[model samples]
Target: MKAVVNERYGPPDILDIREIATPEPKAGEILIKVHATTVGRTDACALRAHPFFVRPYTGLLRPKRTVLGLDFAGTVKAVGTDVMKFAQGDRVFGLTPGGYGAHAEYVCLPADGTVSAMPSGKRFHEVVVCEGAWYADTYLKKFNLESGHRILIYGASGAIGTSALQLSKIYGAEVTAVVSTSHLDLARRLGADRVVDYTDEDFTKISESFDFVLDAVGKTSFFRCRPLLKPEGVFAATDLGPWWQNVILAIWSSLTGTGRVVFPTPRSNRSFIEFLSARIELGEFRAVIDRKYPLRDIADAYRYVETEQKAGIVVIEVVPEDVC
Candidate 1:
């Protein structure tokens, strides 16, 4: 099998296309012939080893796992002896450990790890690349949004933001999406009740309070948006928290806060995948794709995503090709 291997962490240029041995399923794993996968912000972050903290898990000096990719959509070519839920021909999509090796023609994953049947009426590429969206949807569910509740989604045009907007509406919140001028139409189509062009206006200056304010891009800090929240409203961002930060925030919020700050860490699970699948089948959610690249063009795909201008998910399609 041919895979894109990153020997060290740096720019997208460090990733190289090379012929590698195909992976086999372990006792509790399944071997998939990867047809499609996605390049997300997280993947780019891992590549550049940004924020410095992630380096310990990814690698201090170089990546521990040479192959990089997190989400996958592919057909089961084989299953380990311990696996009984799927057969050789089943189509599935899910997340993998160590940002599983989905950037290749073949990858292996645990049988019970974030794997699920692809949603009906959706393409493999679309379903497989939606793991990030599904994860975001799960987090939004924790808020239990209700009708008439005003909610704001910042970075509403990215994969997680787009999913958050649609899921918030489905959960009955009156959605307000904050996006760049070019992506206003895209956010509106995803069911935002009101769209704010962040490039032209500052949303915090508007005279309105929201029950929930989600910064999907992690670009905004809690202090900057605290004034925009209602007394009981919640402000959420994707910034990973240190243990101390979590504890301190919890204590401080209990002491003197009307509004609270939250850092949501996305988790992958089968139920969340199933929930997202049901929504997709019901036509309540749709995958937003920015572009698709062949496996050899993985580096180029990373470049496109790093620009921060991509409106949604960027995918890599892995197929059997004779090129070295």
Candidate 2:
């Protein structure tokens, strides 16, 4: 199996594709021959180990997991003992949040983990989405988002942002998507009740208030969008914010019982994967693909994702779709 190997924490240039031994599944695990994967903000953050806080999970001085891919879509090559849910040749797509290795031709994950069967009639590339939706759903779940509630999604063009927008709609929330000019139409097409072009005007200055305000791309802060939030409204950020203020504010909110700022730490599980798979089958949610790269050119993919300009997911073809 060929995998993207990054032994150190640095730029995308540090990543190299190397031939590595394919993993065999352990009991209660499944071995997947990865056909497609993605390089998104999570992969970029893990690759560089940025923000100085991801160190504890990735590694203190270096990356513990050499292959950085969070989302994977592939076919089950083999199943280990007691894994009755999946069989060889079953198409599967899910996440590898526990120990990411999906940037390769093969990955092994617990059978009962975030792994799930591919939605009926869906291709590997089409369903190669989990990390972004998982994070977005986590934040929404933390906010306890409900129908008829109004919400604003900042940075609505990125992977997490796009997912948040679509999921918010599914929860019956009236969504306002904030993005630059290039993504204005895309946001509206994804079911945003209203689209705000941040370049043309300030979204924070808009007249409407929201039950929730989400910084999906981590580029904004609670203070910057506080006025948009109604009283008792919640502000959630995907990033720690500039100078780690989101985390600090989250702690303060928890201690003070204000419930103002929330920095959700996403937990990967099969339930959400199952939910997303069903949505895909129902044509209720769709991945927003920006670019596709072969496995060998993953370093370039990393560079693109790091730019923070990608419209949505940057896919990696570990195994070509034709082959799959």
Candidate 3:
């Protein structure tokens, strides 16, 4: 099997294509013939080991996992003896933790882990974004978003941002999205009730306030968007927080008034996957594909995502010959 292997973390260039033996499913895992996968911002972050804070878990000096990819959409080539839910040819999509080998032609994951059957009539790219969207949904649910609520999504053009926008709308919140000029149309198409071009205008300068303000890109600080929140509104950012920071924020928010600053940490689960599948099948959500790269071209895909100009998901077509 051909795989994109990374011996160390630095830049996209560190990734190299190499031939490796195919993996077999473990007792509780299933081996997937990857048809498609995505190179998301998280993948890039893990690649560069940026922020220097995540290194403790990702790796001390180098990445623990040689292959780097988080989300995958593929068909089951083989299943472990204990896995009765998935047969040999079920189409599925989901997230993997340290087992980030989706960039390869095949990946093995626990059948019960974040993995789920691809909803009928749903495409691979559409489900590729489900894991990230599940995270966004989890965080928004934490903030108690409800119908008739007004919410603002910063960085609405990125994968997480776009997913947040669509999920918020489906949850019945009136959404206002902030994006770059090039992504205005993309944001609008994602169902944002209103779009703000952050390049031309500062969202903070606007008079409107929201029940929830989510900074998908982590570019805006909680303080910067405080005024945009309603009296009891909540503000959330996707940037990973230190363990102590998460504890402090949780404690502070419990005793504070008017607003709270929160860092969202999404836990992947089956229910979330089921929800995403239903929405995608109903056409309530859509995945945006900025570009598709071959397995060996994973490096170039990472470069494109790091630019922060990508409209949506950047998929890596593992089986390019099978892609339509």
Off by over 4 Å in 3: 240-251, 254-259, 321-324
Considering summed lDDT, which 10 consecutive residues are worst modelled in model 2?
96-105
Global lDDT scores for all candidate models? 0.80, 0.90, 0.84
Q: Give the range where candidate 1 is weakest over 10 consecutive residues by summed lDDT.
A: 239-248
Which candidate gets the maximum lDDT versus the true structure?
2
RMSD of 1: 3.2
TM-score of each: 0.91, 0.97, 0.93
Best by TM-score: 2
User: Model 1 over residues 163-282: C-alpha lDDT tens digits?
Assistant: 888888878889889999999999989888999999899988878898888878767766677788998888777654444454356457657753386544566667777777788889
lDDT of 3 by residue, 1-324 (tens): 999998898888888899999999999899999888999877888888887888997898998888888889889999998998999989998887563888888999888888889989876766788655876887788888889999999998878888899999999999999998999998888899999999999889899999888888767777788899888788888764444454366558766843487765677677788788888889998888889888777889999999987877899888874572
Give candidate 1 misplaced runs (Cα > 4 Å).
240-259, 320-324
Candidate 2, TM-score vs. the true structure? 0.97
Root-mean-square deviation of candidate 2 = 1.1
- Per-prediction backbone clash count: 0, 0, 0
